[model samples]
Target: MNAECGICYEEYDWKERIPCIGICGHTICDRCRISMTSKKCPHCVRPDAFKDKNVNKQLWDLIRFTQLVFRKHSFQEEEFSEDTKRCSHCSEPSNKLRVCYDCCIQNGLVHKYMQEAEQKEENIETVLQNIRDQALCGDCVIDGVHFQHKTEYVDSFIESYSRFLNNRN
Candidate 1:
């Protein structure tokens, strides 16, 4: 059984996890599926392989079962504390106080910057840096890029930056 998402490498959670199976019989996470520009299978590189077919219910069931078991083991003895703080975008309790990237996007700052950057033909690094500078919180940087037209370029820039930082350490 697949334990983590191939694209983001994040462990599948019961809530946000939507496993999509490509026609080539490969699975990808929901985020990557949504962000994908081409309908090709990312793993097999097959053209027009992924279709809007049925979701992998078995995978989802497994994730839910794992979540239930884990929750029982991890949080059963702990007090259920609710976060009073709310997200700026969805207005859901954020649990931690932070700027919401979705909110920033909804407010038009991200779009404005993206438009200006495209017009200027700014380098990907420069565009990402500009966004980072204006970001009110880490989530703003993490989630905002997914909504941009230059998502792939920005993602590449972030990966490169992460590698640079890791090498420096």
Candidate 2:
């Protein structure tokens, strides 16, 4: 009954992480909702049951209340395990200990420079190969924002949720 989604087991947020309730009354996070296979409630296995899903406002309110309670209790900060922390790119903790791409680039983990002709002529495969060669974590090929374009390393909602969990002590 906490803020986590039963499907993906990720924490809910007020923005994109909002929870949705299926016709069968099972709640899932928006991420899972978007990835659903057949508009069916995964929990109930009812085909098309989730065609008209609604936002679980009550659960969202409960999450807010819980956040307020935790803040009121003055919970102590706790250390986070690698699994609980998210990657700056994909926002998933697939690899908990990977270094940021900016650091890698600065440290010469990848080629410092490519020829202008090569850079202009490079294909997607070449880019992917470079990303792999750099050994950057967080699915850079698929989900990474260019380092120059990155304003925030972590998702704000996930960061807040991590704080909430860590302060439970």
Q: Evaluated with lDDT, which candidate comes out highest? A: 2
Q: What are the per-model numbers of colliding residue pairs?
A: 0, 0
Q: Top TM-score: which candidate number?
A: 2
lDDT of each: 0.51, 0.55
* Residue-level lDDT tens digits of model 2 in 1-169: 3568887787776556678988888888777888877898888898777687589988877765665556431111123343454444433333322444454446543333455453343344444344433333345533554444322233342354335334333
Off by over 4 Å in 1: 14-16, 67-169
Error of 2 at 56 (Å): 0.1
Error of 1 at 141 (Å): 44
**Residue-wise C-alpha lDDT for candidate 1, range 1-169, written one tens digit per residue:** 3367788887555345567777788887766777789878888899876656446677777765665556432111123245343333333232333333454356543442333335443355564454443323235435655344232223444455445434433
Check candidate 1 and list the clashing pairs: none
